[model samples]
Target chain A: MAWDLSSDRPIFIQIIERIQMDIVSGKYNAGEKLPSVRELAAEAAVNPNTMQKALSELERTGLVYTQRTSGRYITEDEAMIAGLREKLAREKVTEFLESMKRLNYQPDEIVPMITEREETQ
Target chain B: MTSLLECRNLTKRYENKTALSDINLDLTAGHIVGLLGPNGSGKTTLIKLINGLLYPTEGSVRVKGHEIGVESKRVVSYLPDHMFLNDNRKIKYILSYFSDFFEDFDSAKAYEMLGRLGIDSEAKLRTLSKGTKEKVHLILAMSRRAELYVLDEPIAGVDPAARDYILNTILTGYNEQATILISTHLITDIENILDEVIFLQHGQIRLHATVDEIRQREGKSVDTLFREVFRC
Candidate 1:
């Protein structure tokens, strides 16, 4: 759910990312019940309405589903999970590569060293 | 769900000047809303109206689906910008008085919070520093599990560190069933925590929206937009 980051970024985007991370990290399993809006808001130290906005967005992306009386739950679709993981991994790789470029280290310089460290381990 | 609080075309005017005008708003349960405005912008007057301390010159305010009166007062716990507690009373005694009046008052929660703030229950309000006095007032406001919590500038008198503590206390102590309305000019600090923000200027609501909507529509931080709109 959303958190009061007090940062320049809009909180709803961060909320979407947080729920995605929870799914990828296995903190919530497919078809499992998600926390109620009020409960998640309290845990995140945010307003309940803000938390609701985030959950509604997750539902739009097919990552979560809502039942009339039963509340929200994680989507059971395996493809949704795969998409989330792929998106996150791509973001991490882009950030890592950008950092390397700034440091003036090419792939040849960085990858060989990483492989060497891996072999030593 | 029905609105827990609503102000319909609310207007408040002094002999020659308007304090608030044509205001219409609604507040539901389980939201922490930011009530923001500059000095003399009627933030204090709005809080007073909501608390039934001041009467609206025109229109009406409903608390929990009824007009602001004795019944409405029972459901609302208000912390005014200025001190309301008797200066001569001990902090502990004042808290006890609050507990006696408000059915939802939690004395244990008040004590636990004061202990965290290093406040001595035995100390009289007159003996404490200004900052500590404000802290005590804040602790009282939040200790209640009221349906609606109306706090006016809860951190204005405290230092930055203490302000952070005050914000944290509000965040942690709130019950899921209650709605908190905080009125202050400190927009940047509270902007992140708000579900919706109502911006007042010249005693009128200029903007009201969810934080996400503001960022999406304006393409700027609330602080940045505030400066542009209200800048000298």
Candidate 2:
């Protein structure tokens, strides 16, 4: 996956978000081995130390685990993945609703608009 | 840990003009640092002093806790802004020259990078385009396992694609314990990869902070902050 990072934010935090998105999207399946820090750093075009810091953050969250003498692997917890997926969905929906309200759409009209857009899709 | 490069009350003057004045800074290991400023901001003068290409008029520069000299030169790999390679030499000859001059030079890694870039080893330096020459220089500089890599405008005067390639090479090539100090005015292109940034203005150090601190506290990118601070 292409690592699209903005310069306004901390790169390590962005790296963590990207990896989390990848895991939730099934780009990296649960229990699968993740790429080494160097490999990911090269792919992301970031400093290796930054990538290492991001991976350690993930390990702290229980989203990843490191095996001695081997490398890091994604968490095998299905519930955690589902929880993250829900959290992301809610955040995106909240953003959408906030924008809609700013455009003068009532909360009542927002649901129908979303339904209409969904049906058209 | 001791700093990899330290400048204490460093000053540089030529005749009546002062290029850098009473500057002091310390850079530790394992960081990709951006030395940022506008034209004639003393960036080059400071880098030249660190590389021992030019002597300071006052104070001193130290590498790995020692004064800048033969021992410091051995650990500091420098890539100047202009073309430092001989235009008459073949790429292979240049690689050989680097290997002979620097004990830390990795000829095999140089060949691998050359092959990856599709640059012919037998091609003369003058035969290649300007961008290709820059790439060759960068490859040579990064092939050294030095403790400090001082790159002067490595991404300047190149297309976006070439800039990306250069950044990637630097990211992958340096030793883990080494520090890279890159001098450039193009802040946004190199900002994401930099662990810390040092802002230079009028031969003085303005600010030195981690990338995260600037973004988190100021709520602006380095490029935006640079424009604000250096507005004409």
Candidate 3:
């Protein structure tokens, strides 16, 4: 996942979002060992402290686990991963629908197109 | 569960004037605390007391459940505002000294970080630029996995770009379980990163609270409050 340093949002939050995207894109497979804090900081050109903050947030959200003296690993629970994916997907759909409504698009005009796209997928 | 640093009604007097009076502090682990104060407010004095470099005329100072002494010195890592490393020694030699003194020094990590900065270990300390020298000092302080890190003015006088680098090093390099106490007047730059703050004014702790709690209660950033509280 790409980490952009110039974003106005906090760096730690951006790091968390990038990791979430990686999970969604399968860049980090279940139970895969993530990079160490120092490695990630070097890779991203961010402070090691910022990287630690991101990792701490991921741990808080149950997306990663630390094995003492070993390292942090991606959660292997497929159900948990799927649950997060579905939750994010729902949020996106809700946002899209809200945008359409604001643009004066009726449910009859947009829902069928969405349904057709899902059917094709 | 023992406190890393403690003070009880600590007081210090300088030349017939009180620098600090009745200042009590109890700090625990897993906290990156900010010690905020204006000039001559005694923030430095308080830290000196904790590091065993200065003795309080009244009350007491303790580290790791023992009064300030040799054992406390062993567990506490201090980075004073001024340069402490010998100007003639090579960076690698200093690293060796640190390793010998602190049993928990992570040599591999330290070397890896220096490599990232493109810093060679053989260079003499006196030959390096000021910013580079500051980084070297910070690297040494952070390489040790000490129980408490007392950094005084860690980034006060560096260039903006280098300032970010130094702050990042501290953030990423230190052990998460250890307590870090940073004393500085640059509250805005570090306000976002702190777990809590101990606002010092006229040699006393005026406010101490979690970052979130402070924002909630004051409806303002700690920097804003600091300016208002210490406004002339």
Candidate 4:
């Protein structure tokens, strides 16, 4: 998939978000080796330094870790991955709710609407 | 930690006008720096000074602690704003010339890039399309193992696919110990691939900061900030 980065936010932060989504969604398995910074940069069409910055931020959050001589890998902490999934899902749900509220949908109307769509599908 | 390029109060003046004024800048190794400005904003002058193609009216530019001289020229792989080479020759001929000229030129790499672009080695530069010529220049410049790569508007008027190719070539040509200085007004296309951006306005440095820093502090991309700063 194309790296869908918007211009108004920090590019590296977007990179971080993309990588995290990949990890939590099982696109990258736990303990899997991540691509080198250069490769990642090319894949994202971004500078390596920006990729480096994002990888470092991921490291700080304990989602990714470096192995020095070997390179970086996705964290083996499955709980951390699950936790991040929850956080991201909540953010998306909140966004959906806000947009629905803007459209004059009551808070009580969203779940049944979702279920009705689910049944129709 | 090594300073790849440094300028101290670097100024260039024409007969009655200043093109670049009192510019002090330092760039260390391992950066893709964007030199951005409007027309007549001295981006070209600053690049020329770095490559020793033009002399400064005052102040100095230093590359790896040496002044702009033969040593600096040897390490700075420059692609001028216009075609500097004679376009009457074949791709292979210029490839050989570059190999024989620059000590760091990688002929194999150049050939690979040309082949990837489906550009025939036997084709004359004059016979190629404008986009192909630009790609050839970018391939040749990037094929060098130089200390600095100074590309002046490499993607100014290219098509979208060509732009992607150029940026991908640049990204894959990563060198942790060398710096790439690219000058262009096309900010949105390149802002993602740049480490730092230097904004020049009215012949002076208006801002110099990392790309993410600009995004964090200003809450917008470099291109948006540039539009706000240099808007008519």
In terms of TM-score, which candidate is strongest? 4
Q: Model 3: per-residue lDDT, tens digit, B131-182?
A: 7887777777777789899998888766676666666666666676788999
User: How would you encode candidate 1's per-residue C-alpha lDDT over A1-121 as one tens digit per residue?
Assistant: 3354645567778778888998999999999999887667667756566778889999998999999899999999978898889989999999999999999999889999889999999
Tell me, by lDDT, which candidate is best: 4
Specify the highest-DockQ model's number: 4
List model 4 lDDT by residue over B1-232, tens digit each: 6688999999999998999999999999889999998898999999999988899999999999999899998899999888766799999999999999998999988988888778899999999888888888888899999989999999876788768877888888746788999999889888898999999998999999999899999999899999999999
Where does candidate 1 stray beyond 4 Å? Answer: A1-6, A22-44, A59-82, A91-121
Give, for candidate 3 chain B, the lowest lDDT window spanning 10 residues.
B164-173
Stretch of 10 with least lDDT, candidate 3 chain A: A1-10
**Clash pairs detected, candidate 2:** none
In candidate 1, what are the lDDT values of residues B72-99, reduced to their tens digit? Answer: 8888989988887899999989999999
Q: lDDT by residue for model 2 over B1-232, one digit each (tens)?
A: 7888989999999999898999999999989999998899899999999988899999989998888899999999899999988899999999999999999999999999889888999999999999889889888989999989999998777778767877887777777888999999888888878889999988899999988789888888989999999999
Assess each prediction's global lDDT (C-alpha) against the native: 0.86, 0.90, 0.81, 0.91
- Report the Cα lDDT for candidate 3: 0.81
The window of 10 residues in a row where model 1 chain A has the poorest summed lDDT is A1-10
| Chain B TM-score in each of the candidates | 0.96, 0.97, 0.93, 0.97
Worst 10 residues of 2 chain B by lDDT: B165-174
Sort candidate 2 into its docking category: medium
- Stretches of candidate 2 exceeding 4 Å from the true structure: none
Decide which is better by TM-score, 2 or 4. 4
